[model samples]
Target: MRAAVFVFKRFCGSSFRLQNRGVCDVAVVGGGIVGLSSARELIIRHPNLSFTLLEKENELALHQSGHNSGVIHSGIYYTPGSLKAQLCVKGASLAYKYCDDKGIPYKRCGKLIVAVEREEISRLKALYERGLQNNVKDLSLIDARGIREREPYCRGIMALDSPYTGIVDWCLVALTYAKDFQNAGGSIVTGFEASDISMATESPAGEPEGLKYPVIIRNTKGEEVRCRYVLTCGGLYSDRLSAISGCSTEPRIVPFRGDYLVLKPEKSYLIKGNIYPVPDPRFPFLGVHFTPRIDGSVWLGPNAVLAFKREGYNLFDFNAKDFTDALLFRGLQKLVLKNLLYGISEMYRGVFLGAQVKILQKYIPELGRSDIMRGPSGVRAQALDSGGNLVDDFVFDGGVGELGGRVLHVRNAPSPAATSSLAIAEMIADELEVRFNL
Candidate 1:
């Protein structure tokens, strides 16, 4: 395509309709942080290869990536040698570096997980030990006096200081990545939903076994395209996409709505950086925390409650089909039965504004029920196994000479996911190299 044509079409937001648009070597099915980061890495690693990223929305980062807490995790909560730990540490540095080079705003404001009473002390100590194992730098155990020094208003008896933890504008980061990808000869097809994917026929004669078939992709607008490989990084719809690709994983995505409260402008400075509660060992999400956003606003939140729709962001956003599907899913039934007590409590808090205010008061005693307001909410895409258990770690399943050998499916890319984007992309690239001779 000519430079003039590219410029004119991009300006018109009709770049995908260009008649001479190039074919793709790789087709990424999602435009969130993971897919875009993967697209950027693939292009950077092999500039000669053509690539395209498809998003259902008119703009990128419209979902999880856009609504995240803006915290750059410190790698202190994950187990050692795990993908979450490795990627978080490495990707945090890369995220900061990219933000610096692009002149995007970010801060190394630090985080704390506080223990309010005697019963929580054991969990607090365990978190400190885990931080050490994860190689988190400058982590310390702080008593009440020390905690007061870090956060004067916090009401904790003991705390775990994670200095490496900080905040960044993730949506800004995603926007920056989109710009970088396009500048480096990559195509992003927004408002183009990936409706279907199918394997191509094997070539005749001496064609290499690895590059036998391309993954055929059809967009929502009824346009069909093909690529030598497919990388599924659909955030909320990841498992569903895998099911469509002929994988029998059967992980039904259960949306958990995490709501927040942006403190009134005057009360914003009540907590300096990020102040967290030591997490429940059984739960995957970090308990409610105070996070300072890049725009200098302090917010509290992220209570996990079942959502009626996969992308439902509001209390009134509901789909009968989605609700019935989740209700009938045997796995969800098992999961609920196993954690009935906690599930009930979370639902109670979800309805009562006072219950949520109590969770906040543990960390910030000055916060009153009247000081809270409905902050923007985000939906978490949680996956459940056939037996009704939440998949807690990164899970990938593929092998040589398989049904979808080279096409690696991303089943669950959860929290710390944005923080781990670049590292995960590198790992995916490495896997392709080994499995398909990329």
Candidate 2:
């Protein structure tokens, strides 16, 4: 085997065909923030081992990582002992530090989970207690006057103020991880859509490396990376990747599109920082909320609705296979039936601008339908179990038999995945050390 012949062009928008590429000790299968972070960490921790990052697209972070609300979540809403809760609190701190060390700019713009109704105060209290249990920094239970002090036009009987909840260009953060991975001598290969992962029984001809690159990682275009170990952080396609590797896809990836309405620039200043509603415990998603991006523009209302396509952004965007998969899935079917009214309400809000503004006005009475217009949208890859439960935690798998020891699949990383990425990478590094005997 030869050393990898790939060269870099600043780690994004660059594609290299794997022509006679050398076998790497590890091949990371995803180019999003988490995959990049893990690859960077793995390579940095084991510099003697060669590594490569394989991205399906021609660029990185072009999906979930790029199209998010860019909020560095403060770990307020997750179950107290869950991976999301643990990693998000620690990841937020690490994200801030990483930005500091990388000179990447971010804003600790803060967030307020406002309880508009008297009955909602109990849920708000629970949320506050959960934040405390999770060690979210500087969480405070503020009254109506305190909410007014923080967001002048906002209205709430009570609110949980997360002073350290911040915003950043996650795409920038992901790119920085790509840079770090490359800087640490890890090769980045774009346009390498991973189609399969299988362990080898014997070495390939002429290599004579004694099964050194035994793990066969293939792409749809017939290209492959023969590596010693594989790590998949596939976001939307995680289940497919896992299934092909002989793992159960019981918790399948279901795409849900969230559509946002941006506040008119003149009205952007009505509220400061993020303003969220008291979430209903029945729902997996945090209901529609106001999010101020790092770019100074304020956005309101990201109503979650069923997406017809995994990569769909528009109301009518459709992929037959994606639609069929969602429609046939028993978990999604049961989920929709259970939350029928809630799903209808989300869909209604997504369709009618006035309906969405009405909800937004709950917090800021000053807002109206005319004060906002459609904004950018993103597809959330939610994982669902066969029994119709939303899998609301981190799920990792490595299949069975020979490949079990050679690959790891991040099957599901719920909301706050972006906030938890760096910390999640540290956990992945620990897993690799013990699982792969690194």
Candidate 3:
């Protein structure tokens, strides 16, 4: 009671830390959109509790969050009744509002998923039904005339018009969340790569309560934070992080590289908003698409190819361990066998720019090889199970023993994670409350 009084007197109206052991209430690992949003949600919900955010990089949102093509998804692509479907729709609305409130600019230029061939019409119609079932706002099935009206140069037999889709810089949005968390008295420690999580062994002197900080998280630098609970959002290294917590590592993170091509400034006007292909249902990836960024740059492509390194963005970037891990994974082997032809083609397109352009010209006949140049690329932290199924939904887990009761792991948050970050945060916070009894 005496310590409580002193603690209140010392740091009133701010986040609280255990007086003797310097233990925080919660420690959030990773500084991407989900991590920042979750940290912000925690502080907002539990203002008196101390929260700390740790990032491996020197700055926040430098990897996936920063490299993505700035499209605010409209929930049209996700399956009905899935978390991605519900959260994406709700999160897009929340994102727009948050951007509005924060004065972060974004453009709601809309999107069109076009079907060029007759065979694709059935798939396009099925997709429309799926979008309607998912409650995607203002989604409509349009004919060839409508496609031409929306995209003057685009040729298609049918299209799904998603007017709610937009573009925003995700890196900017993530940084805003970071700001909100900090303003609410949350602590952020960049360059702290978390390497271990274990039950705390030490207690504060004269503390009546034993093991106040029951969890200790150590970084690669040997620095540590003592906290009562922990939440991890390790995007690319999520499986490794889970293993360190004594959890199953069956669903490993496999990196996929997506390369984009930027349109010449003079030709950028030819493509407005987003023009996407009717994706193959068997695959987890959306094929090459045209997207206009918030920065006024029009990008084409993002062909999916296996990356040698988990975080590698360039074609030649390689990590021996990463390559070995991916090459030996049973799930990857199965997936490769099933999609060998597609994989070979993707690899071919990666080397030859003209092959990709040839596909692009199918939609926009005026697009020439010289109208585009090599642009930025991004690496997707795709999770795969032993059964060779690509995880397309949120996957959460915890440690195996005592550590399990104290920590929660966000193992996989698939695409549209950025669009659904706020909603994802809300869902995660609910789980945190139940799992950690916060």
Give the alpha carbon lDDT tens digit for every residue of 334-435 in model 1: 988888888887878777878988989988889998887778889988888879887766766551244366577777876789898878888877776676
Evaluate model 2: give its lDDT. 0.87
Candidate 2 residues 1-438, lDDT tens each? 333343434343543333335478888999888898899889889999999889888678889998899999989888889888999999999999999998888999899999999999999999999989999899999999999999999998999999999999998899888878887777888777888888876788887658768898878878778888889999998999899999996789999999988988998889789899999888767888999988889888798999999999998999999999999999999999999999999998888889988888899999888889899999999999978899888999987998889989999977788988999999999998899998
RMSD of each: 4.0, 2.4, 5.4
lDDT by residue (tens digit), candidate 3, 213-253: 87888878676778989999999999999999999877899
Q: List the global CA lDDT of all models.
A: 0.78, 0.87, 0.88
- TM-score leader: 2
- The count of residue-pair clashes in candidate 1 stands at 0
Error of 3 at 102 (Å): 0.8
TM-score of 3: 0.94
Per-model TM-score, in order, reads 0.91, 0.95, 0.94
Give the Cα-based TM-score of candidate 2 against the true structure. 0.95
Rank by lDDT, descending? Answer: 3, 2, 1
In each prediction, how many residue pairs overlap at the backbone (N, C-alpha, C within less than 3 A)?
A: 0, 0, 0
Residue 310 in candidate 1, Cα distance off native in Å: 0.8
Give the residue spans of candidate 2 off by over 4 A: 1-20
Candidate 1 lDDT score relative to the true structure: 0.78
